[model samples]
Target: MALPDLARRAASRPRLPSLASQRRVSLCETLDRVLNKGAVVAGDIVISVAGVDLLYVGLNLVVTSVETMRNWKPAGTPVRQPEPLSQEIRP
Candidate 1:
């Protein structure tokens, strides 16, 4: 077929519906999926510049539910509160 005929056929075809016109997800559902069932990423980053190693970084990430965070506490360590800012005296 000629180029003009191909272009005409393509233009006449129906367009697919956009995602906005489809189903909508609620904020609570999105948060639940992200915070509760999210993926955990554990990796390291190495930077090299001018044929020499410059910086090495270790990255560990954990994504969990709010309940897990609330119930988590360090072993054999007590939670300490910071002193009030007003109690500090400066000469």
Candidate 2:
């Protein structure tokens, strides 16, 4: 079979934003977001020998700043909201 036209194929695809157009994120911002929202990593490891399972291990980890952890609340608990700057507004 004849080779497909490379230029024609590429032209059909949509163009992505150039580097200049994309927003740049700083390391501090990335860490702040991660700590603010927290991240959970969970996984399972299994070791087998000759089709027989020999060992199974599971791991779960949560990464966040101390302040973030302190603010965490269990399910069904009413969240406390900060008072609005304008006291005139009421629920």
Candidate 3:
């Protein structure tokens, strides 16, 4: 009974596509849709008249990704540039 159940379980398990195939499918389905389309947001800015006065009463914050977070660095910090190779020297 145990052997038959094990074989049945192995046979019934769904076959998964390879990682490369999965990546291709994901790119085709979601990434392509987002890249090749524009998203338009239509909504009301003010829910109520009372909310206008409450807007500035709380903290105002901006969120960004790690790659873009460096742009917010304070002034005076030296940004390091990569050294050029010897072959790129000008005459």
TM-score of each: 0.23, 0.19, 0.16
lDDT of 2 by residue, 1-91 (tens): 1112322222232232453654433333343454444544434554323311111110011122322433675678754432221224357
The candidates, ranked best first by TM-score, are 1, 2, 3
* Local distance difference test, each candidate: 0.33, 0.32, 0.33
Model 2 — which ten-residue stretch has the worst lDDT?
52-61
- Candidate 3's TM-score reads 0.16
**Candidate 2 lDDT (Cα, whole model)?**
0.32
With candidate 2 superimposed using the best TM-score fit, by how many Å does residue 88's alpha carbon deviate from the native? 35
Candidate 3 per-residue lDDT, tens place, 1-91, comes to: 5433432332232233665543223222332354344654435863433542243222111111211334545588654322221124468
Stretches of candidate 1 above 4 Å error? 1-21, 43-91
Q: Compose the digit string of candidate 1's lDDT tens values, residues 2-52.
A: 433432322232233454554433333343454446555444554323311
Instruction: Tell me which residue pairs clash in candidate 3.
Output: none
